[model samples]
Target: MSLIDQVLARAAADPGVRGVILTGSRARGTQTARSDFDVTVVVAEQARPWRHSTRTGTLDEVVCTVEALADTSVHWRRYSFRGAKVLLDRLSGGIAELVDRQATLTAEEAVPLARANLDAYINQLYRCVKSRRDGLADAALLDEQESLPWLLETVFALHGRLRPYNKYLRWELENFPLPDPWSVVLMPDQVRLAPLCLFPAVESLARRRGHADVLDGWGSDIELIRAFAGAAGP
Candidate 1:
């Protein structure tokens, strides 16, 4: 049997193993020759040692109980299962269905997340600007680093989309993308230029979504940054 098959057979025979799923690059069909299998085995209540062998390549496994999986606060693990492929599901509680459900966000969830992300982005933008004005190049660079992810998350939340892992960001942008000019500015290398490109788009989205309060004063802030950079204000 193949490595995957053998692994599934072992999982199916375990009474504690409620479900088995394949995740990571292999599950997503983006694996390289050296990519290892990332399997998550969901159990009833307790965790167990991960099974692995060099001969069959790495079988990176995580053991979690159904209760933990059901908890909304346990987001990272659920996010990992978003693109997972189910191998064996014998749990009567519909654990596999729960994994599938976490792939997307509801509008209610997206709105607050988007607002929070925008708040964080604006805070970071201010820090970046202040650091630059004060001639703290290192501080400015650090602020910029902190700002980018917030900006990306804000954009994704505004569009009601899940933010993919960093490795899949380029692919996600190429295939899904945020919206017009916004996506153009969200490139990894264009971090410094993001505020200049992102402000107008964010302002528009905030207004359209009745979130104007969340982005209040953003226009003036953008103008201030642009003026400081010797660029024409929008």
Candidate 2:
């Protein structure tokens, strides 16, 4: 049997291991030649934490209980499992289903998250510009660092999509992009260029969603940034 098959077979026979899931690049069909296998072993609530093992050269194992996996607050873990490949599921199939469900954002969750991220982006953008105006170059750079992620998250949540981890951002964009305008914001590398691309993208999204109120909250600041960014040029 192959190494992966042997590992799954062993996990299936273990009374303590209730389920086995394969995650990371291999599961996503994006693995490079150097990539290793990542596996999560789910145990019962009362069981001891199963030891993480790397006995096989290319396999890395993580152990957690169903309770931990079910906690939506553990977003990173949930995101990790969202695209997981089930190996052995002797736990009534609930683990696999839970992972799949958590991958998606409901309107209820997305709307508030979008608003919060939008507000945060505006706040950071304001600080960035203000710092530059005051000749605090270092402070402006720091604010720029803080602003981009919030801006990206805002756009993703507005579209009822989860913002992927930094490592997967390119993959997510290539596979499942947002509607036009917003899509180009992430393409640029310069901080000045970001606002130039992002402003119209956000405006387009707001107009499309009939969320005029969302843009209204930061309308003036956005315009000010847009003017400055426009003068800065590509």
Candidate number with greatest TM-score: 2
Give per-residue CA lDDT, model 2, range 1-234, as digits (tens). Answer: 986788788887878777888888898888998888988888885555445756455889878787766666644555676467988777678878766766877798888888887778777877877787788989977887788888777888888888877766766766777666445456444323465335555666756766667667775777766664555455
Q: What TM-score does model 1 achieve against the real structure?
A: 0.80
- Runs of candidate 2 with Cα error greater than 4 angstroms are 47-57, 182-184, 187-196, 207-215, 218-223, 232-234
How displaced is residue 145 in candidate 1, in Å?
2.4
Poorest 10 consecutive residues of model 1 by lDDT?
Answer: 47-56
What TM-score does each of the candidates earn?
0.80, 0.81
- The C-alpha RMSD of each candidate to the native structure, in angstroms, is 3.8, 3.3
lDDT of 1 by residue, 69-164 (tens): 666654444456656788877865486776776667779878998999888877887787788889998997787678777877788888887767
161: Cα error in model 1, Å: 2.2
Q: What do the candidate models score in CA lDDT, each in turn? A: 0.70, 0.72
